[model samples]
Target: MLSHIDPNNQPTMVDISEKSDSQRQAVAQTLIQLPLALKPYLQGEELILKKGPVIQTAIIAGTMAVKKTSDLIPFCHQIPIESCKFVIEIDSTLKVMITCEVKTSYKTGVEMEALCGASVAALTIYDMCKAVSPQITISQTKLLTKTGGKTNFKRVPQPLYGLVLTGGKSKRMQQDKALLKYYDQPHAKHIFDLLSNYCEYVYLSARREQWCNTELASLPTLVDHDDDLGPLGGILTALETHPEACWLIMACDLAYVNAGTIEKLLENYHDEVVATCYQNPEHGFPEPLCALYTPQALKQFQRAKTAKIYCPVKVLQMSNCYFITPGLAQEIANINTPDEYHQVRHEHH
Candidate 1:
């Protein structure tokens, strides 16, 4: 795709004079699967290295790569990067995945910048550890996602309250459960703040038209259903916005919520895609709207949304949902009508 621009032929940077000045961001990731023997080197606790610390060198090298992107890629336009942040996360199998997110306020996007940064960073890892083991394999070198470059794009969809649908919203709950309040903040805002504890960038998923950002009118508010179909609709939106990350879908009406509860959910979260389990006297295994979801449930939710079975419990019961049963039921109390809202509000919200 980048083979078009000829900087030498033009002798000057091509003018994106007609392009819109929308904010642009790019996310690139590279997976480095290393042997368990080398995992200790990356633990960062006591990086006692005769050569030097491993991660510190990688960060410095990655930053340099960001500046040299245009020179490395001939057709790529040189962008003055405003900010670049790199994160390294390790999977249970000792595989280190590095993500580079670059942001810029300019005429063009910084995808090349982010890609170069991540690639160089991964290569640095290989260069540092090749003497110990030659079995390092780097794969999945594609953009995790990018938005705002002449067009809006997302690798996945998202939800409104914490970007995942944990359950269905009954009409009796005049207020969209997500709108309920706790800690002097709305329910959705509470969860939004909590998820920020784990994720680098947490976004609220809702129809762009339904909500307004008083602070930043231009901040992207994701739209679902192209219309509103309730909680499942928001869930689909979240899946659209961030398809790769694990989403915690806590019902807003859940009164006894806290960040600690979210940490417990994340602590018990299995890679097999999981949700919280609540045993109801009436409904067996009442799949609580308080669950964590992954892209594994996207297609099922899409099909259900089409068939009017937008309830998340049904999806959990019928599909392969890893249930997190910590016997934490009190935190799952859902608020329905005004009376219930007040009742829960007064009793320790």
Candidate 2:
């Protein structure tokens, strides 16, 4: 029976008063194709057109559409939206994908809200980019997934990998931090072994000069594709190499990170957020080096790269990231210099 049609064949709204209230969520996605000629103008975070910053404007438009979904769609129930999030990405093929996730605590689903949000976001991109090139085409508007209410569902979790960053310049340390022995083994080898416990596959992120170490020759290594960008380049290389996998990244300089610290991070993982990071107790910011980054976060990193913002910490600061402080604050410490290394070594021993 059609809920929108009555026995008298008249259009009517479904009565949801009897339905029990429960948390509900939905996700929708759409893509916009830009002509190859216009791709050059689409810079990092903002494409400053005559209208405004393209990506930022699309985000606002998408959020507004989520709130006004009921007004636009006649049959959709007005939902009290608890939250709405957007993830936008521009791939190598010049296809821009916009995903909208909507959440509510109500009797009905928020699928329409998600769809509306994604549609509006795509339209906003088209509007902003039209001045640059009229060849922009929006397509693939559809619901990606939904949850809560009577039925609950989700897409498969992306594959996950462990990435040990071993490319730091180590100017202050005056030696390769990764090669320094902490537990009678090279720091890089120690971290790799730790990550192996939780991750299905592990790889080392290194620079050209660091890749030829005879001790590290047997292990899988990813040379930084953009060598000048430091840790940011390592992360980008990992994401670019395996776009479908979530990366659990650990820096070589983190001498105190152990199994318990990794366990705590994994236990407190937040899938909805782009990344789950440790909050630096000293600096009061998310520690970028030790974190679990989902595929959504990788896309944001791509956007940051386009905008010439090479700092991963800055990207995490701006995006929706879940941060937690370690029980032992010292566990997250980075041994950047010989003094710091000696101090940590003494403490551990």
Choose the strongest candidate by lDDT.
2
Best model number under TM-score: 2
Q: What lDDT does each candidate get?
A: 0.65, 0.85
- Report how far residue 178 has shifted in candidate 1, in Å: 16
Candidate no. 1 TM-score: 0.49
- Residue-level lDDT of model 1, residues 89-155, one tens digit each, is 5655656677888988888988888889999988887788777777988877767668777665444
Q: Cα deviation in Å at residue 280, candidate 1?
A: 21
Model 2: weakest 10-residue lDDT segment is 151-160
- Predicted structure 2, TM vs. truth: 0.56
Model 1 lDDT, residue 163, Cα: 45
lDDT of 2: 0.85
Task: Mark the regions of model 2 whose C-alpha exceeds 4 Å error after superposition.
Answer: 1-158
**For every candidate, C-alpha RMSD to the true structure in Å:** 12.5, 9.4
